[model samples]
Target chain A: MTWDILNIIGTIAFAISGAFIAREVNYDLLGGYVLGFTTAFGGGLVRNLLIEIPIELIWSQDYLFGIAFLGITIAFFMPDNWIGHLKKWVIFFDAIGLAAFAIQGADYAVSIQAPLIAVIVAAVMTGAGGGLIRDVFAGRKPMIFHSEIYALWAAFAGFMIGLDLMRGPYATLFLLIVIVIFRMISVHFKWNLPHKK
Target chain B: MTWDILNIIGTIAFAISGAFIAREVNYDLLGGYVLGFTTAFGGGLVRNLLIEIPIELIWSQDYLFGIAFLGITIAFFMPDNWIGHLKKWVIFFDAIGLAAFAIQGADYAVSIQAPLIAVIVAAVMTGAGGGLIRDVFAGRKPMIFHSEIYALWAAFAGFMIGLDLMRGPYATLFLLIVIVIFRMISVHFKWNLPHKK
Candidate 1:
């Protein structure tokens, strides 16, 4: 039940984020819906593909799709001033979504008995892949590739899960909180990966 | 045996194409290799995922990967003037690759008893998805979405295969030739899909 709740929250948050980006790019309504749907589910879809899970699993989540659509529709209709005010909150929710999805992805990989590297990859991809795809579609460099320490936190969670250091709902919840805090701190500090000048 | 040969030809052509694009974008050798590999196999990867085929099928093609690497390496070492002179040949090989992959993808989908729409999607994606992914990684809009009538030929091929109008190796070869000629003609004539001004 807890996992389901977290998944729903993450889906709605990603849907709104995608809708906002579509609006920024001046995409039509259909584009907005497509982007919104992709953001909400693209990560999981990629993860499932990598893990060789049935693609039908994605189609089975009908309710989640409805929730994502609802979230995007609401975002589409919101006033500009309201969106401006919600920017910070959107970031906060995005962090929550990232954390939840990372943990869930790691858990799924671990359950499947995937190798440690695969587990970590599943986590990072599930956490950041949607945003990467979204940015690519919007004709921008993927933020995860150049921005603050984002996917690294997801990697950390995956490592812990792969090593069997984290298990159970409480432990998972604790890790999720830690990752969210670390991600937010990195954002606030403007931390970045090293690159050649 | 024929399918395997066609697959190899397509893979090498795509790898060279990808390496050229990576060079155009000023990516390093490593980037060239990555892009080349993606452009060679990303379409099949996506097609398999959509068709629920085991992802391991991609990894099993060890020889194809080696050929792709070789093709990219050759492209990387070639002088710029040589590349300019070979540009038309590259386009011709690319058309061959597109037709081969499209027919192969549609055949696979039909063999699996997938619906007509799925077969058509499989064809188009297998034909053009690698280039789409390559352009996205290069931080550019997908040319297939806006450029010449590339995927439509793939769709036409797929439709024929799905309806069982084209069967047997001889018929398949004929269709492949037809698609390649149509693609080349489209390029020469500057054919394009309709869009808003």
Candidate 2:
């Protein structure tokens, strides 16, 4: 149940980012939905393929269509007011989604007994791939690759979840709280990695 | 030996069409190459995955990288002359690519023992997918969907190839001729699919 909520949360968060990017690009309804679809599934698609999951099975997954349909509908209907209002909450929503995806993906990789390094790699990619894709298609520099502490925060969140899981029901709420607090602090301080050039 | 030649012939033909479309869109160098790349590879990506080809092994097979590099180079350096001198040749070049892909895709499917219906579908997709993707990213209706018997020609070519392997080589050449002739006829008559209202 908790995992399901996180999945849904991630989907919605990415969807919002997708729609925002579309608005920024001045795409029509179909274009917006296409962007939204990419943003929501780009990460999972990469992750699944890397893990050698079959293509047909990915399409057949129930949550697949559910997320796509929801995203498309939102893009089609919410064009005018959505982009501006949505951008306001982007920092919060995106951070939550990133954090949730990081934790969930790390858990799945560990369950598959992936090597520790691979787990970290998957977790980071799963958390940031969607945004990177969205940024590229939107013709902007990706947040993670920028000096922003965005991907790092997600990585930290995923690492902590992995550590906690290795150690108890370890309240899912606690995980969420930790992610939110770190993200808020990071954004507040304009925290970022040091740049060489 | 024959397959290698046919594939290059097809790629050159497709590259011309890709360059033409990108030029039509007034794409910059990066955009033109990107469009050309999509035209060369989209269908194969879709087919390789669907046919469960252990795609990693087959992904870079044939003249993909060379042709792609050649195509993009042409799109960049040779585009102006190609567009100016050979406006009438688009139909022929596109026909060659489509026919070659149709035949090759059908043969590959049969070699893998796919159902005839599946073979037909794969052939059509492999022949058309790249151009379709190219069109989509450029925000235009796909050439086949918009008009002039392009996809139909692919179907015919694929069907002929799948009917028999030994005869398939001659049939591919025959299909190429047919597509070129028919496309020329369609262009003269200004034939097109009816626009949906």
Which candidate ranks first by TM-score, i.e. highest? 2
**B80-171 in candidate 2: lDDT tens per residue?**
66566675665566666777787777777778877655576568778886876787678664455434656666666667666764364565
For candidate 1, write residues A30-53 as lDDT tens digits: 888988888888988888878776
Clashing pairs in 2: none
Q: Model 2, stretches more than 4 Å misplaced?
A: A53-57, A76-79, A161-173, B1-13, B17-38, B46-52, B56-79, B85-197
Instruction: For model 1, name the residue pairs that clash.
Output: none
Chain A TM-score by candidate, in order: 0.96, 0.83
What DockQ do you compute for every candidate structure?
0.13, 0.11
For model 1, the stretches where C-alpha displacement exceeds 4 angstroms are B1-44, B50-53, B57-132, B141-197
- Residue A111 error, candidate 2, Å: 1.5
* TM-score of B-chain for each predicted structure, in order: 0.97, 0.82
Estimate, for each residue in A85-171, the C-alpha lDDT of model 2 and write its tens digit.
Answer: 766476676777787777766776677777666677667777887777666656556767875587776566557655655333366
I-RMSD for candidate 1: 5.7
Give interface RMSD for all predictions: 5.7, 8.5
